[model samples]
Target: MVPEANPRVGQLTTQWQRGKDKIAAALISLVLIVGVVAQAGFAWQVHLNGEEIGVVKDKASLVALIEARTHEVEADKGYEVGLASQVEFRKIVSFSSDDAEAVKETLSEGLEFGLKATAIIVNGTEVAALATLEEAEGLLEQLKSRFIKTSSNLEVEAVRFREDVELEETYCRVEDIVDKDAALNVLLHGSEKLLQHTVARGESLWTIAFKYQLGVSSLKAANPNIKPEVLPIGSKLSLKLDEPFVRVEVVEKQTYNKSIPFATTYTTDSSLWTWDSKVKVAGKAGAQQVTARIVSVNGKEEKRDILSTQITASPTTQVVARGTKTAPSLSTGTFLWPTTGVITSPYGMRWGAMHSGVDIGAPKGTAIKAADSGMVTFSGWNGGYGYMVKIDHGNGTSTLYAHSSKLLVSQSSVVEKGQVIALVGSTGNSYGAHLHFEVHLNGKQVNPLNYFR
Candidate 1:
């Protein structure tokens, strides 16, 4: 009778057991999923060098806070600033949220802050710092550009700093950072010290200013009481020195035109004597354009590289015809003007004495040529004629050059017409720089204007 239990009860008990087993499995699965999620980090905590600093919702939130802090520091410092500490992040499972504003406030007040800037360093020493890399580069460019010369004849190709310059991105204190103007001043003048100069005897304003590379007007402007005509001895004068500290190198492409000297060619003919010659073709100078790469430091040229040379015009060689005929005539009997100048003083005798010569006005170093082909009979210093040259032609005429700076021919050298024999000078018995030319006919002094072609 006990084994015959109710069939409905047995069925109900088995169903309840199955329901309980299903609920337990679901609970276990939920616990496992919770455990897995807990293993994965849900939040990030900030650390400084291994010490826990703070926590944030996410990396993006942390970054936003940092940026905001940086801007805040900029507003307060009147310049741009970086975080002072080495920061790192670690993941942790936590549900608590961090106050972003509180973290930023802590950064501004409690933590030491620095500006993230580019520093111009030389030889591992920090020279200056700027807000951005562009500023840094522009500062250096300005430094180099100061040494560049801009002109139609010069094209600046490149500019650079000669020093071993380095731009390092570093986080430095606000006090350590320098403005562009301040940095430039440091590189150019190096100090705020004033310069002064004491005047000595025989030192004029122009000479004193020139010695210090300053303009006379600037010197005068600096000291008002100082007079230009009379500089007092032992006077204290203010001088502003323009001295540079950095070495800036500049590359320039310079274009210049040069003249090519024409060569002379001679040909002999049987009809004329060996001393007789005629110009067949006139000589012409050529022109060439040269392009050179000039390297300079601090406005002083250091090196030059010839890049290209273009011949703009070809030179025409001068051709002259000579004769081999041996005749009794050695002179053409005609003459060319000694030099290209105006006849300043005519041959006369009205100056209480015999002037005896004509004066040709020319530059001091102008070339004086032979009037006619002849043999030089006298060349040296004469009493009133400071360097003198006398040429005797086979005809009855002789030419003389007086008051010359130099004589090219000796006593026996044969000269041709238009040959440079001396330089124009005011050597003896002269009022100014001029060529004292004279002509002698049968040993008698005559007017020199009567014998030129």
Candidate 2:
């Protein structure tokens, strides 16, 4: 103002003021940018029931971590496990207070937040749930197999679950997810047990089952490969308590043929010896067709019914002839000794019993002669008198030679006096090799010494 405002001084002063204004604007812009950056800062925080669980930069990253933990649990427990899908966020807000690692550590402590899960409902009853429907179905299938029976001739009509299965959303601790296999085992068997049994000598299926308080049918069902009838010694058998969850019924139709045996008949033939026979017809068996219906449950046969029976062929009857021939010999009431031997026991009371005939001692295979024989009546095994030969002497008198080794003549054959009719033998109540001689007059046994010469 004093020097009329020097132009260079005014221009310099204006430049300084403009520079200060530029610096102030730059500082204000920088402060506003810093405030915006601080306000825009974001982090995802997981909370359960208004309680903070963990904080992560991204929600997806937290989910990935939970999945990794689930895989680890699956490997350790040998089952399928996953983070429950029913997890709900109480708050999803920006959280810059902690890093991702600190949040992960806090979640790993399992103190506040829990995993969302699905509940398995069976017929309105809760059972269990997995992370996925496929895994849950797999577990249920395993349970079904435990109750199923195999290797049966019956046809399985259908397999259905006894309960209505459904999946429901729920929440639980991250460690509460059940292992698929173990859960199935616990549901089916109630407890885990493994018992082995070995067969021993004289041990039968019934005995073994009784010893173990088990049923025979259950044993058969458990051991399909072993035969119930022929159980080998030292063979092992698996023992367990059976819990059936499904009813399995099997039906079968069978057809088979059975044989109808033939019958035999005999006719008397007077032309041959007593022991001889001839077959006039041969016997044959017949066939019958049978149809049956069988019903079984859980590999056990429950009922069987025969539908029909048809005779395919008739059986033929067999006819045979038995000989009844006899030899006759004429006599004059006078007789000769049948065999040459010493009389060891005479006809009288012997050993508290009446001796009906004389016992003439002789060697085996000795020749025996008839004493005026008439008709041969009996020849064969006789009670107390073995190999006897009875002859009618035509004059109301008959002669008998017992204990003979062989008979050379047949019945109904004519013979003369003094003929050799039989040989001596030790047969029929005989003490040694001997001949028993007797004579009868009109069916009455008498002394033969009066007629024999």
Candidate 3:
């Protein structure tokens, strides 16, 4: 009645609706599949300047991957890549008075690189930095910027790199009831290497090499950068020797005692005085006995070979006296006036000020003589004393001859009493040819006339 329509048309419309639903479901499934495939294809890679280094799966592999990449880069660049294990570094820094604490705090924050830092300081001021050598240079720059306002200078003392490699190993079994020691020998001889020694204090490169039956040239060649003429104390030098040498525990203890003489000029009267013998070196334990005579000339010490060392427990101590106990003997004869001169200034207070020494007027180039038997301590232009010569007489007495035209005796040269020491002239703070002479007792200025008679 309601115009009962075509059943075939109705059925066709239902089929069309079902086909559309199927198509929609297929599109959704395809989208999900594409998303999963894309995710699977994703990867993390590192690159420098668009050049791929390597691929890493996740964050956990970052450190190892980076190290590998760096190694690869080093190889390509032909860089001599020092193993991180072998490197050591040190640093020294100075900070201003106000910013010392802040600078220290910044340094304590640790370096960006994975290296250990040990700081040594004096009064909250850092004096030394210890770390790996590779990290030293870069960290130094960073520290410089950080403490630019606080510190004016910084220094690095020693950079060290060392490594040990183990190459091969082998196992051996006893064969047929031979001596156990013989089997041990075979095992030892199969793969053996020499033991090396490091050059230590009081030890020469040649001596160390010779002790180990090694070649001196070989040792020198190994240490190419080290100058043979100027080997620093405690430098590590190489040693060569055949294998199977016994490790000798040679415990040697040496005590060295040295006497040093110090003299100071008296500020009051310009007199020179010598203090008691002071100990220059305290006794210490050493691996071997070292005995040498050191002569100090002009504040410089020259060491000469005295004796070769031997291994001993409680070795005989080396005693070096600064000078002989006997005072320098002199012919107690009246000394003639070094130059025909008139007294320009007396050694005393004048013009409401202290006149340090006696000034004698003479023509320039007058020869000056040593007042007593002693060593020439000073012969140079002093600030206000002009060209000065200080002589040390052994009995805590000394003399100063200043304002000289020429110096005759150099510092530390032994001279006889009345021997020519300098020439009189106007040199420092002088108006004309004159000799300024003063006497000192235990480093305090006294009247030159007290010792003149």
Candidate 4:
């Protein structure tokens, strides 16, 4: 109608319109691609208090990462986050009453927090962040100064990292000293094997062995030359279980000087020398070989060896015979029998036993006298000897009286010759009333017959 609008023109217009629509669609697609590229190229830097810590690529990823980090922090700090933004974050830090009580006391007056702060920059916008609950708690103080209120009872002290720790030093101590070989040697061979006995009246070697839990053979082994059946009472005897040997070697020598004065003089006048003076003498000595013999307890010689000997000092022999030779007075005292009794046993072997001490068979209650002047060293009932008395004469000699029904003297009492010391009886291992008498010299029992007459 409007000048018969050309159909071709109309068709061209429609074509142009379709072309325009296509271009618009292409432009829209290009815009979408640009948006996607921009988003893909978006990057973020994460920092703790301006110190770079990590990076993120896109807005969505950044948000997700921050949320995840916040969750991690919350998990660690046992708290929850409320708001997170580019400028600040708000969180609730919860502490157990038991844990918070101490913190409450320490921070009741307000505490300064040492923050572990993180700054996240996205699209040129800086977002301060705290990743862990501990960081959030630390940031709480800063936020409080900035008028950010938080209901937190968390008081975190500044962390001081250390690579090494100090420890106490220890020292070793010595406890004992050791000499193995010497100790072992002593343990193996240092003990003496011997038996000891104090002689009792009527005790022969046989009776001694019997009383001391040994055999006659053992007693004989200890005492080589002794006849057991005639053992003298009051004698000390040794019974050897084994022979003992010792080795001695001289290790050193020393000398000493000695001056000896031999005589003394008495002067009545102090003038012009009637001279009372003593002569001094010097002595010289040398060394000699010394030998030791190991013997059995029964007096049997087992082994002998020479040890070293050195002169310690010089020796001088000064023999001074001062008394004139005169005949000694003959002893004239009558020897009374110590006990009044019949001689039931003589001083000889009887039946199978050797009679050691003479036995004077007496009725019970017969008085017994000391044979000589001596000190009573023993007054007691000895095994198989009844009651006994031992008198010690000076010079290692002694006498024994046994088989007493009663004792009149105590031990260590002095008695004169012919003093009554006991009443004869059968009080110990005796078959009848009798007095047993024995004699000893230098600790060795000798036959009474040798000295009686």
* TM agreement with the true structure for every prediction: 0.39, 0.35, 0.29, 0.27
lDDT of each: 0.80, 0.70, 0.53, 0.53
Indicate the TM-score of model 3: 0.29
Best by lDDT: 1
Which 10 successive residues of model 2 have the least lDDT summed?
A: 84-93
- The candidate, 1 or 2, that scores higher on lDDT is 1
Q: Rate residue 61 of model 4 by lDDT.
A: 42
Candidate 1 error regions (>4 Å)? 1-129, 141-160, 163-198, 232-236, 250-260, 265-294, 298-300, 305-316, 320-453
Worst 10 residues of 1 by lDDT: 103-112
Residues 280-375 of candidate 2 have per-residue lDDT tens digits of: 889889999877776666456778788889999999988898877533336664667777778888988888998888888888988888777576
Ranking by TM-score: 1, 2, 3, 4
User: Residue-wise lDDT of candidate 4 within 107-136, one digit each (tens)?
Assistant: 222211222333222224322233333443
Candidate that scores best on TM-score: 1
Cα deviation at 13, candidate 3, in Å, is 99
Model 4: number of backbone collisions: 8
The C-alpha local distance difference test score for the whole of candidate 3 amounts to: 0.53
Task: Tell me how candidate 4 scores on lDDT.
Answer: 0.53
- What's the lDDT for residue 62 in model 4? 39
Off by over 4 Å in 4: 1-335
Using lDDT as the measure, name the better of candidate 1 and candidate 3. 1
